[model samples]
Target: MPHDENSTAGRVATQERIETLEADTEIPAPDLDTRPPSSGATRQANDDLRSLEAGLDRLQTDPEHAPRAWQRFTTSVLPPILFVLALIAAWQLYVVIAQPRPDIVPGPLDVLAAMSQAWESGRLQTAVLTSLERGVVGFLIAVVVGTPLGLLLAEVKPLRRAVGPIISGLQVLPSVAWVPAAILWFGLTDATVYFVVLMGATPSIVNGLIAGVEQVPPQLRRVGTVLGAGRTRLATLVVLPAALPGYVAGLKQGWAFSWRSLMAAEIIAVGGTIGFGLGSMLQQSRELADIGGVLAAVLVILFIGILIELVFFAPLERRMLRRRGLLGGTR
Candidate 1:
């Protein structure tokens, strides 16, 4: 009886103490009428703030770093690659399906086989190297001759007025048109081919240079004058650099003309002395009645042209135009 009484009395005293503490703090007890929601509300707000911070971190970091390189490569480089593959595949398909006389359309496999055979026999490399050497040498000569001529045309108004139309017209003239005359002039020698190539290229290069000069801002010329640039110094430093892009364009056009002219001359005036260029190879294939060889030669011509354009002009043009801000960075 004494133990039970003491226990009951202690429980009453503990309850009274809890009631008194709750009253002093002005907070309801958990088991009583109600409890304050402040702690739960704070926890919820903290959770929301943490979630928002996490989201912002994700937004700022991930998109800029890893995928950009891949995106650029795919967007900039892949299309050309895919186009080339498609073109080759289409050519192969056409060759397979047409089943034309070998003289008319050679299969891709046949062309490749001939290429391989030519390589093994050492003739392909010899022919390619010979053609490349000729093209490069002829192109350099054209640049040397044409560039000065172009500058003259650009600076001298009377000369420009006299020859500007002719220069532009020369670009459209077929290189084949010069073959007969070139042969007549120089006969079967390489000099004849070189001469024709120079004739073919020179006009285009000159025109390009003239155009480039014309494009240079008049203010720049005024600036040069104020800086005490002499005629020669102005031409060399201010005008030439300003007109370089047009001059480069002329070179590209000139190369095309030179290549075509050489080919035409080689085909019409065949000789061992001419060596084996794409044109000579093509002529030989035609004479031999070998379609596969003809196709192979054609492919070689196209590939070489594209290679030279890409290697020399494309990048150079891009750089120049970009520097000038004329290209708008499309390349």
Candidate 2:
């Protein structure tokens, strides 16, 4: 009977310990495991990438594909204006810091006033027009003469072998160096200026066209040959079109040479119907020690250079590059 009572006591103790443990700790509820994002979410991401690629392709291929209207305000108009304002601010700061004598280096305001005076008097317009006309005429002459010469060289192996190096060599020789010979040959007339411009520009244009022709793909030549094109027709229609970029680049450089050559001739060959160009005007300002006038003339020269490059050549270059898909469209 005592053994039975001891066993009952042990059983009661075990039961009490089990109840205490169960009350102290809680059991966790069964739950499902986390799964990844759905297939619809993945499909949405793929569609977005495809849309982006399509937009980029359109930008490359479509000329009329305009950027959003807001981009015009943000990119086309505001940035250049802001940059010009910044440039002016920097000029003002420089003037404040340097404090040079007016005759030595006139401030921006002085140059502006001098330009205003010339503009009001109409001398600036006449002088600028004179320079522009000469430069444009000279450049056109170079293009007319140089393009044919370049093509001849490109088409004829024997002639190119004989004269190609000579043509390139002339490019290194300064146009000013030719001015002395030109004056001796033609005297100080307009002929001398035109001669200098031609000498300066022709070699550059020739070399540029030659380079473009050289870069024309052999595949393109083969294609033209397969189409039963003769040498002249192939070059004119196929190879020349392919070489437009290098040729255009050459034209740009040739124009630079023409402008510089014209300026140099104007400055050095002064008097006797040489005409009053900005270069001559600058020289006169220097002679009189009128720093503002000198600076104003320089500003006008810079403006014209920038204007032509921006308005004419830059657009042409961009259009060519865009058509080739070598450059993306404007943002």
Give me the candidate number with maximum lDDT. 2
Model 2 lDDT tens row, 1-331: 4545665775555554443334224543334235433589876998898899999999888456756768857976688879988988888788889887777767789999999988998878888988898899999999999999999998788999999999999999899998889889888788888999999999999999999999999999999999999978998899999989989999999999999888888888888778777778878878888889988998888889878988899889977888897776665
Best by TM-score: 2
Give the Cα lDDT of each candidate. Answer: 0.80, 0.86
Candidate 1 residue-wise lDDT, 1-331, digit = tens: 4545666775554554443322336654667546434588877988899899999999887442323557756976799889989988998888678777765766778888888877888777887888788878887899899987888889999988988898778777876787778778777778877887888899989988888899999999999999999999999989999888888888888888877777776677678467777777788778888777787888888889888887888878877877776774343
lDDT of 1: 0.80
TM-score of each: 0.74, 0.77
Q: Residue 218 deviation, candidate 2, in Å? A: 0.5
In candidate 1, which residue ranges exceed 4 Å CA deviation? Answer: 1-73, 94-103
Clashes of each: 0, 0
| Residue runs of model 2 more than 4 Å from their true location after superposition | 1-65, 68-81, 329-331
Question: With candidate 1 superimposed using the best TM-score fit, by how many Å does residue 125's alpha carbon deviate from the native?
Answer: 1.3
